[model samples]
Target: MARIVRKPGLRRRGSFRDWLTMLALFAAIAFAAAYLGGSEPLRGRAIVVDGDSLEVNGERIRLEGIDAPEYRQSCTNSGVEIACDKLARDHLRKLIARQDVTCTALGLDKYDRTLAICRAGERNLNEAMVRDGWAVAYGDHQWLEAEARNAKRGMWAYGFEEPSDWRKDHSGEETSRVSAKESVTLHAKRMFASLIAWLKSLI
Candidate 1:
């Protein structure tokens, strides 16, 4: 019988290859977990604060990438005075009606509200508002804004002051008053009540 011969360094090479394979596998897993694990999807009913602001689960979120009119801002359409801000808010309310909202929290804004990209069903709320001309694109939504303008949608159909300009002209007290008045309306009141109920159910 021929004596079995151990190949020089073969066992060592096999062990090294095994180690490398294990290391690569672990690296792939670590990469996947690190990239995918931290995303916590936000979902809940919402309380619309204005056209571009809302609250979900007690956390205020300012819709990122757009700006809407202030709650008391006004404009003129065909020489007729219009409450552009209320119109914007009401449009948002209609868009978010009875839908579950989802948001990806980007970070906090200067006002400490969560800046987020939010969606209600298939609609990206930020883009939708811009496309509908109720909100102006702020960050990366200029294309949507231009499209809305070209199509003559929402604010484009009527002459309106930019929301930022409107806010700049108003005092803080006036702004707050408008928000307070809006919150007391029947629709807004019901929305707040629903928000409370939804939160309670969660606990």
Candidate 2:
């Protein structure tokens, strides 16, 4: 019987291949952490979804500490009819202004939108909305909201139902009343208005 001998370089090549495989795995984990839930924060250009909702890099997020009027909800300012919901959304759009937004994931909302405390530059978007009177502080920012109300800013400048109240009163009516075409048209208008507002902010 002849003794078998293995080449030394062959063993070295096997070890190198093993190291490459480990490196690839680490890269994959890092990629997932940066893009999904991990130590890194979620950051992206945001699209205003509604008064209290936004989409960043295709992920929907809800402001953690505030609620704004629902789309189609109406109000009055000095007895003149105002579209409070649209205005609130527009106000948020103006604040974001095509800036890079960063969100710290707080959790998930009942609607499945990621609940987050987001910021544009150094400005906290959630608190900014409440301070400007476009949104009502829900969890613990009521004091800031009170200051906005006292100043009669944004939605506080008008007589309007609380967003939470409006939802209760409507209760499925919004979905039943708005046709698909009407909803699409309204969404387009809102986006156009947002674009114009963002452009103005740049000037």
Candidate 3:
């Protein structure tokens, strides 16, 4: 009765392969869900809500990667105060100027506002705001901020609290928010660097 001899190793290998296939399928499903659920681009005439926010087709969108002063916030220039927030908002308005704005959604913010990279014609509104110093680089556009600072453009010429700090001060909340997108990107970069280092060590 030596008719049955199934090797345990073969069964184990089959199980492992099945597990891997299932994992891959789950990963693909999750990716598709995230993509399909959000990330739909919004396009319409943009009404300037503030420096870093706009209303497009009745939808409120917060510009991603930049932060502008609160609408009521002010700043000091030389020895006089300036309504930097108003200036920033006005700058944004001028940039849009009744043009059809296109916004590509990244995700939603804590306030449930769609976070997006918006463009007016061929110009990137977010980059323009930071480059012109109407906004500060919250998670991206560090180089443009530097250039604006060096050039002393818009709010860079004035002394103002960072938008997040201003919000915390006025709202009496201790919220120092960082962009989730930026945090994830930074983590990925670090992981890649670590992997490269490990590979180099192996060499």
Candidate 4:
């Protein structure tokens, strides 16, 4: 019986293939991290979805720490009716002005939108919106809101309902409503997604 001999190059090729597979796997994980969660920043040209919302790289981001008028909400400026919602949206669009926007994800909102503090160049979009009176400070930027109010800028120059108040009054008309059970389900999904992203970062 002849003794069997294994080629050295064959084992080397097998090892290289395994190494390649691992590299590909890690690359995929990193890509997922960029989108799913982690500290990876989302950067791209942003489309103003609303005053406090943006679409970047196909991702919907709600500007953290601020709230803007609902899309159908209106306000009065100098006793003249104005589309405050459109005004806020237009102002945000002007601020962006086709600039590259970068957003750092904080977490997810009840709407399942990524909550982020975004910037265009050196300007913080959240702060700018509040400071300019296009948005109201929700969890942050109170000083900016005060400044805008004192200056009588944007919505401060007009009479309008608070975004949250408007939402409550128009809840019946608002289409984003989710049932109590659905909200809990979505919240769990968000938590799970966050955990998975975190684990992927470790690899």
Alpha-carbon RMSD, each predicted model:
15.0, 14.4, 8.9, 8.9
Q: Candidate 1 clash total?
A: 0
Q: On residues 132-170, what C-alpha lDDT tens digit does candidate 1 reach at each position?
A: 999998678999999999999988888887776676677
Residues 2-43, model 2: lDDT tens digits: 999977799888787677666655654454345343235699
* Residue 28 lDDT, candidate 2, scale 0-100: 49
Q: Tens digits of per-residue lDDT for model 4 on 120-201? A: 9998999999999999885658999999999999999999998888887888543343333344445655655676566556
Global Cα lDDT for candidate 3: 0.81
Q: TM-scores, in order shown?
A: 0.65, 0.65, 0.72, 0.68
Q: How close is candidate 4 to the true structure, as a TM-score?
A: 0.68
Q: lDDT at 156 for candidate 1?
A: 85
Residue-level error in angstroms, candidate 3, position 197: 42
Badly placed stretches (over 4 Å) of model 4 are 1-37, 172-203
Which candidate should be chosen as best, given TM-score against the real structure? 3
**Residue pairs in candidate 1 whose N, alpha carbon or C atoms collide under 3 angstroms:** none
